[model samples]
Target: MPHTLIRIDDLEDPRIAAYRDIRERDLVGRKGRFVAEGKVVLNVLFSTARFAAESVLLRENRVPGMTHIIDRIPPEVPVYVASGDLMDAIAGFPMHRGVLAIGLRSEEEPAEALLARLPSEALVVALAGISDHDNMGAIFRNAAAFGADAVIMDRTCCDPLYRKAIRVSVGAALKVPFARGGSADAVADTLEAQGFQVLALSPSGKQAIEDVERAPRCALLLGAEGPGLPEALLSRLPSVRIPMRADFDSLNVATAAAIALHRLWRPPTL
Candidate 1:
């Protein structure tokens, strides 16, 4: 096992440039991968062999529940320990939960690539403008648990692979295959061309989600919290609504998507 000790006093040392501008990845441009904070998030990440942690940062004394997590990492992987302040300086945040990790950025994937991997039995979730990281993350968590095939999103949606989205999803975002780009209409055009029906989610939509016949191929189109589906999308695609309490304005987009997916996409009994 190899060990490299970094002192808290040397905060500006450039040995680890990747740890400095943590927020740069939040927007866009030539940024590195997302950071997974805390032991709980890292523990969730342990299941994903696809994500390789470039490094792990830990507090000197260590977190209570994370001793097992540290043992799971390969002996050769770089693990840095610092006092709380030092940990924050490296991580660019104050809440240096006794441990942290840098999760590898996922490779860019195309919708066609995702489409090709589909089994005859596949269920997928579609999201648009779900710019809120927490919502995007929660939706992914639910999708992974319920057996959804993929998450399709427009370019405007937040990066599902971003740090916060991954943390919020407990890293379920990584497990789910997602493709971003193209408007609902464009994605619909491609999906339709691929023989999928674009079921647009909306409140007043005439068709109920349960009423729709499940097909071997289907895409669930979702919008952000308040804007609802793009007006043009409704005109071009078949609009469907989840049955809900009439008095409520609407369910949160992630929750609504979960309910609809469960009802529409239950795997057939063998």
Candidate 2:
């Protein structure tokens, strides 16, 4: 397959506008687009059905090793190559990986639609008010690792498609099926309506996680680290706590989620 590698000699070229000032754009802009950095993430971006690349920016020297990957990109997509210094100038910092792709967000099914589509026996991770991008990304990574059917996030949660979150998840943010933007209660209600037994994780709960038997379909609800789940919500659901020493009250939201997900996980058989 023929590859079109457009050398980026001028930093001011409008074609590479999306790659400029990458950090600032990641913070307040990007519209419905995202950055896929490093070779690993770029590979996932190309393969993921949920996303499509508008263009790719790569260090000219790094193209040799990425030939096969570049060849796989749809011909309609432009491939831009720049010198290391030029790449650094455009990004406003050293992006050592030298491989970056700008991808547009693909539409996702609604939470209710996604829930109704789940297999009869499914495990889901629900996040409420998880404002930290790192934690959100880690949760998504853990969800993918544990074979979670889907991850549902409330409106207050950070965008998992943010560059840092996607990088931290190592592209799991793209691989894992997810739905965002709803009130916490609304999310829980949707899960319950789909015949999912929702379990809320709290440090003070009477039941140990191990003691709770797995349901045919389960949705584990987690919240931001310090505030944890709201008391009103906690009171309504069966709460389970992880056993820990008295000195520490809780684990980071992401770590706690991993533990709970692993315990509840039932891997699919061939």
Candidate 3:
């Protein structure tokens, strides 16, 4: 079965309503749907079994260039094409990438369920109060680059599925498995219950990141910038800090995560 390229001529066409005013829709939420922009992200959307592509919207000129990617779409999903002008109109902005897709997130997996599914030997990135989208995306990208088993986010963290975050991650957000709801302490407790050695990342951490030994199952816990992990939480966990200049005591949460993940990551054994 082949994917059908549906021509979208009417600006008000209901079929593409999901792609309308994308930036605004991003804020209000998409009702379980997320927009994947650009060729790279769309590739993940079509290739991954974790999410379903409800439909795709491409600038008319982009169709020829995107045939390779479009061919991978499931036969049942519609691929929409429109002129660049109409594409901009539909999106409520200039869409330079000319590639757009709406993907459906199935009911989100709970943090406990996600943790239970990981292999006995795993490395996880646990985040707290990280509400910035770019940082959220970057952390996920780092998680993917470093081969972390999964990411668990406290309730205060921003949505990794947000369009801009997904874009910043260069599609890593789609590839990384993550669970999004729980308090900082609750998330840590959940990771600990799963036999994970949870290490908090803080500037004042007693141990240097390089000095800490990786456990069979380890989790690097990070908190938001400025006001890092809570004092009480920091006091409870064995913590590690990245060595830095004397005056500088902090790194962006994502930067800290990348550094910690790189140091802690081990390649999977065959």
Candidate 4:
């Protein structure tokens, strides 16, 4: 197959506008769209029906498996090949695997959806104000590993679909169901309405995580390292502490989510 070439000398080509200004993806911005970089993440996105490709950018010359991936995409999906230098410049970053794709943005369900859809028994990880993209990605990865049914985050939290988070997550964010949190009051009200036990993880807590009685549904609310859960969330939920080494005050958010998910959630015997 002859290579399909795209020349994008003008950075403002509307066809590839979604790939421009990669840094702005983290901030609150216009419509939702996510760029999956590298063949691995791009392939993962490609395999999913939930995410549809807006366009694809690839480097020219000896790109492997180009035929296989292209066949998977419908002809309607736009494919553009460019020089390796142009690929990097258009993406505003280095091309790790010499391939990148822009996909339609999607959001995780809200708490109500998670609560209603979750089986009679469910384990969920709720994140509040975890601003770091790497941490957000790691949280989803851990959530997927330990059988957490859903991930809930605050509105102020970083966008999980952003490029960095998607890379760090290695596409686990695509698998784990998540919801944006509304407000501390809203979180408490929703949990109370759903009858889920909200166990907020914080050092100031009195109860050990092991001691908490497991319910049919539970959500572990984790916060960023320093600020911890906001005061309102603390005041609302029953606080539980994860017993850690005295020398170390806390684990990384991802590790803590993993440990919490493991201790609290395990698949039932088939």
User: Which model scores highest in TM-score?
Assistant: 3
Indicate the residue-level lDDT of 229 in model 4: 84
Alpha-carbon error at 71 in model 3, in Å?
A: 1.6
Q: Candidate 1 — worst ten consecutive residues by lDDT sum?
A: 1-10
Overall local distance difference test of candidate 3: 0.91
**CA lDDT, candidate 4, residue 256:** 77
Q: Estimate each model's TM-score.
A: 0.86, 0.96, 0.97, 0.84
Please, what are the lDDT tens digits per residue for candidate 2 over residues 218-253?
A: 999998998989888899988889999999676899
Q: What is candidate 1's lDDT per residue for 29-84, written digit by digit as tens?
A: 33547777767678767666767777777788774456678767766667776687
How do all the candidates rank in terms of lDDT, highest first? 3, 2, 4, 1
Scored against the true structure, residue 185 in model 2 reaches a CA lDDT of 90
Distance (Å) between predicted and true CA of 243, model 4? 1.7
Distance from true position, residue 151, model 3, in Å? 0.9
The pairs that clash in candidate 3 are none
The residue-level lDDT of candidate 4 at 199 comes to: 88
Better of 1 and 4 by lDDT: 4
Collision pairs in model 1: 123-149
Off by over 4 Å in 2: none
Residue 137 CA error for candidate 3 (Å)? 0.6
Q: What C-alpha lDDT do the candidate models reach, one value each?
A: 0.76, 0.90, 0.91, 0.76
